[model samples]
Target: MQIVNENNLGEFLERKALKCKEAIKQNASLLNRFLNLCLVFDECKDDLDNAHILECSSFKELFLKKAKEEDGYFKITQDIKALDFMQLNFLVNQCANFLKSQGLKANDKVASFLQNSLEFVILYFACFKSGIIFVPVNACYKEDELAYIYEKTKFNYIVAEDELLAYVKCDVLKLAKSSFLKSILKHKKDFIMPKINPLDLAMILFTSGTTAKPKGCKITHYNLLFAGYFTLHQIGLRQNEVFLSSMPNWHIDLQATALMPSLRANACFVLLKRFSARRFWQQIVFYEANISEVVPKMIELIKLQNKFAREKKHKLRFLLYFLNMSNEKYLEFKKRFKVDLFTSYGLSESIVGCIGDNYYEKMSYPAIGKVFFAYEVIVANIKENKLIPLKANELGTICIKGRLGYELFAGYYEDELNTKNSFIDGYFISNDIGYFDENALFYFFSRNKDLIKINGENISSLEIENLLSSHKKINNASVICISDALACDKIIAFLELKEYPYKEEVNILQKNKELKQIEKELITLNLRLAKFKQVSEFIFLNHLPRNYLGKVRKNVLGEIYGRN
Candidate 1:
């Protein structure tokens, strides 16, 4: 798989649209017009600065133009018209006014516990439009987890669904909790809007707790807008482009890829309640969505769909995947879907979409693409407390800096110590290790903490897990290093099988044999690993515990594997 260059990208987009039986000739014309307008806007920012033009209105006009020209195109699931964007802005103003009338002051943290709905968008924008800081809690979090975040963030007000209100237990907190129910009853009429600046905190997204407790990353309006604008440019998304979002909006992946990017481009966004493999293709066909952001797991699930099996093809033009798809699978997906595939690497702390690679690039180098606009990448050695720029193809820890780097979250909410520790001097240390190849493509190896040091040799748990995952019989796998009395920490592979024949018969011995077979597979995998990094033990589990983001909970696995 070669890195897709600009020429390759053009060809790929053309081929994708052709497969959909839609002529790109018309789309290209519309795209040119939209792109030209964007260029004009970019060149003449002074005139637009005071226009007060609603973002949604711009999106609707473009959407209608495309639909009208394309014959009632299937482009969006949301009923987004020019009026909707204006109405949304108006609603946000109203909501902000309502909050202020309730006596909430500027810089007040307004927590929202809701799914990806119109209301979520309203509340988010309302917070930003006003001076309030929005704290979006993951709806999938358990009551206890939510409570931890609430306490950590110390939000003064919370807009929550009626169902989620039950999870609020006042007895657990040392400080008194302000009830939204009581607030509405007490002062319903006093709410007004608060003035805000671009620097004002817009959101606080918690990192998925895969290795440790989740930490909140506080992002500002400037950070989001800057990142959003650059991302839209990088992806070449134009007004009238129908963007489909399937991932949970709370995650930074969705925020950077879909929500913010769409708004920045004034593009139509189709938000789904949840990802459904069955309805994925149907929705694409129905909406005529031109672009979508997907995770690797979702792609695998979609490949399993019966509709996909029978239909033989799809109309998708472009797919931006967050996870690293293997070169083999990447090529196969391109051939099968007839769409351009783009992969990128990013984290919540960065606030910006760091690096990305589109599928049309002929160079199949494993790098996560080049540094985003105004961002610079550096490979450094942490131990010496020194900066070491590795030559192309030399593996090292990756660090980022520059103007775009400043757009990274201000800090963790209420945890100044952790925030201070996250950065080294000026450059923010991402804690992930990777290296750029000769083509300047970045390849992520594993998190700094995820590396297991056995007898001074560092081992990547992710690398081992990736290998085991390639096996057809293994449904999921997690690799962890556990301490041994004599040998120090030794690698242990935990596996979940796709099929266990003995489960029906309720035969423990047969199940053990199946587990042993998996262990044998791990033994073979051990040969490729360093001597000290080889798996010394194997554990067969019905399932591996995962966080809300579906990443394997390595901390929990450490405890389980250690206990056994």
Candidate 2:
């Protein structure tokens, strides 16, 4: 990846600003498209071959026909079982009947604690057909985390893998076994369809807990459908496109970007059990996938791959990159690969916030782009009880309100107080800190809780983290707040070196030089920061800790560093 020299950084940023402003003027029509969520599908042509969902008999009818059709095949599969659409439908229908026979009613919560196999996909669709609410649990959750969710929701039934059964505190059904499918098949093929509504709960997505317990966010049928429409419109995905799905089902991005969009566009999605950095490019080339979803951490690992030919040999048109990396890192990857990188600003609470692809021409790296269709977003000073709107180029909490009860989530499941507190005057408080320029391009900073206050100044941890990441030797950086001797919070920076030149057998003198080199880089970094914002201390580590979703666990860092 190429890095711009300090001499050109200022010029590059200025040019980016000018280009963004010009692009905003040119893409005025996109704003109108953004306001009409339901009509987005209308933009697709009426040609049966061109529209995946509309041309088909129905979503349910298309499920089984794809496998039997000469052109259709098992698009979603894994090492365990490569299921064609027929097999997928068989399992989904059987599972739906099994759930009905079990006396589970519509809107009943069914926890899916299975691995990333075809069974998981089958159960997801089954829940939809049967009108059962799908609640996917991360396969990696420990017993305590699992227990927390169980106590909160009181799920009517749970479908879990045999290996993970020990974590289930209550009775559960095993997936991927013949006996279960046989029992399901014994029931009638046709089942009563529940009265459905767009506002009815379809799924309950739990947050990737950082400090507190995970809170379940209620997602409605309309919410998921709109998310699919927004994704297709934002990413420019067309019919018959191929998407690579590697992230877990628990993540909203996987469902929104890959699963839901594929269903909407009649596109093919290649599903993997888990993300494998070594196998990612090969799978893309093998399946001829046109689009891929990734986070910054995945890109960092991919950048380390020495197979240069794989970088350009695939059919990848672009990658949906979540905005978390520094500007330098983002630009370096984009420039080195010469691949289209579309970034979006969003959270699990809302499938999307501001989308960058719509403003591809005016889009600036490290910027969150513009607001999504029909979604009103603004930065407000939440610290002030009034939640007054912030002006252009001012940083504050990001607040979003969708076409009332449509684009956004329903609320936190069973937590009325927290849910009520999350909204004010129709806007859902996102606790994330960000800002937008006069041209409406948004930029994300650190979370509100991550801000470091020292000497009467509020320092953004992301700012220092971004500067540290710009250093050539630093691979990644995480900045956290620590209590200082001055009775205020101070910034503690944790860095992972790009390469460790010293081996275990290396002499002590050489190891000391390696340490000195890192210290020297920190000294250089301090020069670019304000005196108060300068890092109070530096801690080098082999790697930074990450949560289940690959987000840095800064609260864990705080706990670890507090005692030290």
Candidate 3:
């Protein structure tokens, strides 16, 4: 006689579905059609045990339940091996016990410093079970970058591969043995779950550090789940579908786009070690994948390869892109591959900043779709204590508010000063500048700060300048973003020589040697930087443009020498 379940899960689902419906009211008919289709299948209770179903509170809960129900459920495919849910759960249990034995309690920081593999996935869920904060450090990070993160968090444990052990200066428990899986299986699978809450810190995602040092954005379990469910509703992803994911694990979209949505929809996620133009379509066809996450640069690279035949042979419904693309390229891709393109905008703080294509209504090529459900977005002037609303098509700082407790990020991890500075009138201030059209579709213009986005990676101009300025021969240096066709921007460095008109210039061969030495020093400095953060080109200048206050005029440098 009860329409809803006793645990209020049914009620929660209904409320969330209603919110989704209201958010996409423009496509109400489409929602109704999808709902009707969902009713055609059994309600997933036919074979699952009652005990397994009772513990389904979060994604981790649901994953554990599914593992128990169908021990052979093919959940993940990496390389050529398909791992069942039970096998993956066993790994998670072992990791949880390992962390527990190390005396790591709830909210203890555990740094994940490895590649994208089954082990990385295990560490991810292990943190969820043990109530440890998961800090994602990209595997390719150099020693200096890794040292900074270690100094800030002082993590209690680190899970890394043996090859990357040199970067760890902290005296934490380093599990770098290649035979870890064999050792973990010896541990008992029965481990106690920690007491966790929706508000507990789930992750500490460091931003690109456009200003100075990077600030870690604190995210909660509820925030991740909310973004996952919202993505599921917006994309209309069907159950038992395959999702092809090649994005870096450190990126927020990797979770928001592939992991969480696939778990919520009960789908299989195909994880690639890295993006490869040659193997992309082959893997898609092999897995029969229905969705893929990509960037504009990848698309351009695919087209350059001229793999036209393979592009249309697979069953991809759409591709998810983050940055903007020209209308010509968007339509050309649709015509060639017979798949829709969904472009979006989001920062490390909020995974789902703006909704991509919903497939209900037609959207402009580059317009990022409407604001997500349960979140209010506005284009307004960010004053000291208030937000002044702007008219349609008027450029202003993008702001968002709603359900900050459960739907938004918590705050910066340890920096109280930055955490306090990022908010105004209880709204999260997105430093990116943009405006909304009359049709309510938002378009991105540029970052208000001098942050450079290159090939889906955020690079700080100041970070580059600081590195280049360390050279003894370089008196000063400036870094700026220049338009690039492949990635969004190419980093260019302009350096001023400490001593000009050298006597070596009188001798041609000696001058050439001096230039080569300078180039070698710059390249050596680049070895310390991440691949995406490396300077694309360097230009030597006698003097750098500066103002009366001795501030380097970066904009002037961009105009004078940024024409690439």
Give the winner by lDDT: 3
lDDT per residue as tens, model 3, 1-564 = 111121212122334334444544655343232321110111122233223223432222333324222221223111222343444555567777877877888889999887766667767877877788899887878888888888888888888878888888778887884755655665766566656767678788877755656678787777677766777777777776777788888888887777777756756676766776655665566556788877888877766555634456778877777877788887776776677777677777766645456746564558887876777788899766789988889999888775543666787778888877778887778888889999888888878546877767777778888888899998877888776665446778878778865341211123367867897889899889877788887777767777699887777777767343
Order of models, best TM-score first: 3, 2, 1
Residue 234 in model 2: shift from native, Å? 0.8
User: Global lDDT of each model?
Assistant: 0.59, 0.63, 0.68
Q: Is candidate 1 or candidate 3 better by TM-score?
A: 3
lDDT per residue for candidate 1 within 261-369, as digits (tens), equals 7766666667765666666665565445678877655666666666444233444556776645567766766666667666677777777567886434543334567
Give the poorly placed runs of model 3, Cα more than 4 Å off. Answer: 1-78, 308-310, 383-386, 403-405, 483-485, 497-516, 546-551, 562-564
Candidate 2 displacement at residue 425 in angstroms: 2.1
State the weakest 10-residue window (summed lDDT) of model 3: 35-44
lDDT of 2: 0.63
Off by over 4 Å in 2: 1-87, 171-189, 208-211, 308-310, 359-363, 450-564
